[model samples]
Target: MASKGLATKRRQESGRRKGKEDGDKTRGGGGDEMKAGGGSSWAWKTKTENAKKVEALREIEQLEQKINNLDREKGVHLYNKRSDFRKLFCTLEEQELKLNSDRKTEKAKLRQQLNKMRGSVTKFQRELHNVKPTPEFVEKLKEIMETIESVVSEFKEQQKQIYEELLREEQTLNQEVTALEKRLESWASAPPITIETKSVKPKTVSSARNVIADLPPEVAAFERFLLQTGGHRGGWDEYDHGTFLRIRNKFKGKSAFLDEAATSIPGRNITDVRQHENWYQEYLTLMEKKKDGIQKWKIVKEAQKDECLTQAAVDEDEKKEEEEQKTRARARRLEEERREQADRLNAWKVQKELMKAKEEEKQIEIEMRRAKEYEKERLRQLEVRNQVQEYLQRKQEEDAIQRLEVESKKAVQEEEKKTMSREERVRFLERDQRRLEERLAKGKAKEEEQRKKSKRLERLKGQVEVQVERDPSRLYRLTEGWKERKKDTTSASNGPVLHMPHRAVPSWRAGL
Candidate 1:
């Protein structure tokens, strides 16, 4: 029994070790032995370093595969790569959102450029449509078109420079990343072997002061500035500042100045440009004031004490160079303003032409609509006159047809009378007269009888009314007599009727 229990315990231990090994393998351990460490455990180190490396390598492989799968046609890679969204489990949604954002930005840039050119073209077209062609107008339109082309070309050049700058930055970053990755791989492949020694070199602890000493004064100053201004809003980096300078140097004017600057710089918007502009203007003014103060101090120093001739000569040369630069800058600014004003005048002319064209079109439409309305009224009047004429003609035709029918009937009657002999005609007349006289006599007798009957009913009704007035109880008796008379009259006129005692009186005998 003791041996069996020991065997069972050993088996349980083996099973647990097997399970742990399986878990480790499943976790990408690849059955490698993990040595015990003094500080962080092997598992923790693997999770942090190895896991991160593996994830990065996988991402790189996926990117490479995507690149390989891209279309070989020129410029298709730019479009096709953005359409790919195979990173579903990790950053698919984020990549799609980024792609959409990039597409929208590109579209917006294209739309802005197109709108500028389109405005000029549409204005020219409107002017051409509304007003007669002239040499002066043609020349002006040509000039405007040329100006639009130049502006577009300048904008394109700025975009090209910005793209080149971005490419250089990306290449430099990639190079640094590759170098660091190579170093990490080399270290990982062959770790340094530590040997136990009795004597150890004294380790020097590097502090912030040592770090500051190692860096140049300019770098340290910049770092200090960065730290001091970290809490301030709308801070731009050196690259952004350089980009702003380039854009400012290229384009100048109040019209779309901020917009152009913002669009030219990737990731910088109008608000950032405005903030930078304010800060830069203040900085320039401050620097100018500072330089003036320095120059005044130098002059005072020279007057109060002896100064080197070489240094004085250098100072004069520097002051002359500064003045020249200021003059050049001023001249460039004035030129830009003149160009902008000309552009504004051209835009106003185009707008006025478009409005004039629209008004002419509206007036022409109104006139055409009035003409159509007049024509429609004339056609309606003609239709009404035709209908009236048709009605009169139809009435005449109907009257003629009726008259012909009466004449034909009369002819037939006359023909029949002519065919009859004289004596036969006389006998027929006597017979028709006798029949007519008999009908008249019967009608008179019936009318007289009806009148007498109505008179008798009236007498009866009056007697009943007089009795009812004299004795209120006599109403039922009179009503019963009236019912009997009604039954007799009904039997004489319409054979027989099954009379109900409660039946209402007929409307013709209601008075009785």
Candidate 2:
């Protein structure tokens, strides 16, 4: 029994080994088949799989048959559509040709009409060109223009004279107004005279008369002379005293001197010198006593005269200023009138120029139209010449191609005459195959080198990535270095460093 069990175990072990060997052989055979058929091998397919393939092939054949029927129908339909399209295309082509012919006829008729119109325009222009104004007519026109100018000048002169008269009246009225205003100002500025009872001094009219009557005749005459000469009495005291002494010396002992003085003096009547000697001597004594009063009176009179002279001078200056203002106004008006005349003349010249320009523009337009027509004809001729040249060039190119083709054919015939034998051709082909194999080997080597280079690049990229991972701020350091280099370069070129102001943080963002 033990022997039998051992035999059975050994047989089982052999069977297990055989089964493993068979599985390995089967796996190896599958691999070999896959390699030989590029993984599409069907030699080991099961019956069911073969059946499925046949069924699929049958379905494909049925689909192919249906597709062939659809293709035949589509072709028949397309043929019918093509026939209909060809008919339509032929009809359209016929219509197009008819339309083109009609258009050509109409274009020819319009061209002829345009030519006729152009000829008429040319004839009219020629006729007009020959007709010019006579010298007499031109002279008459000039005379008419001059007459019109003279009339306008006369009108302008009358207007200017009227304007001057008005200006003069205005100036006079202004002067009068100024004088009235000055008087008003003076009245307004004058102090009011108030009579107070405490300041009043009462005197009888007879006393005033007696004072006047008591004055020496010579003194009175000197006063009258001062009034007539517009002289103040400030310095008149010396004159009066001197005159009194002179009169006294001349008429003290002579009656004839008094008579002559009375007759020579204005509005004086002295009958006897001996009869008036006592009163005259009394008046001289009174005048001598009132010297202080006379001095005061002289000062008051001088002040009055000075005030009057100042007022007169002010009025004169005002008058002179007014005259100057009027003169300036007149000059401005004359200048304005002259400018208006000049503007009128300029306007007339501009009008004449505009008329001449319009005539010239018309002439230029005619010339331009003629030139355009000539240019159009020239362009048409150029187009015809260019077409001829292009046709000739195309013909020459075709001839050159034909010649090249003939040369190539002759070369091919000569090569055919010198053709190698089959063995030699086979040897040349083998040589070319060997050369191709060498080129393929070189290409494979180049590919290997490129792969090695790519692997090296990949290794370098991995090292750089590991380095960057080790130091995360390396990029920032690089950027800072680049910025420093740029700054150094800029500083070297610009010669100075510009310090920028530090940016201020907003109050809200200050903490951040």
Off by over 4 Å in 1: 1-321, 332-340, 347-355, 358-366, 369-377, 380-389, 396-512
Query: Where in model 2 is the C-alpha error above 4 Å?
Result: 1-397, 400-408, 411-512
How many residue pairs in model 2 have overlapping backbones?
Answer: 0
Residue pairs clashing, model 1 = none
TM-score of each: 0.21, 0.16
Overall local distance difference test of candidate 2: 0.56
Model 2 residue 316 lDDT score:
65
Determine the backbone clash count of candidate 1.
Answer: 0
Query: What TM-score does structure 1 among the candidates reach?
Result: 0.21
Model 2 per-residue lDDT at 57: 58
lDDT of 1 by residue, 1-512 (tens): 12223233333343344444435444543323454323457667666766666675576567656644442221232222332222221243354446546546655675576567657656765665665488887788788778877876886687587557655544444433443453345345442322222254634433322343333344334333333333112256567777787777767635367888888888988988987787667555544664565466446545544434445455666566776998898677657755765797799999999999999999999999999999999999999999999999999999999999999988986776566556665877999999999999999999999999999999998888553347767755657667777664544657656774785554433543
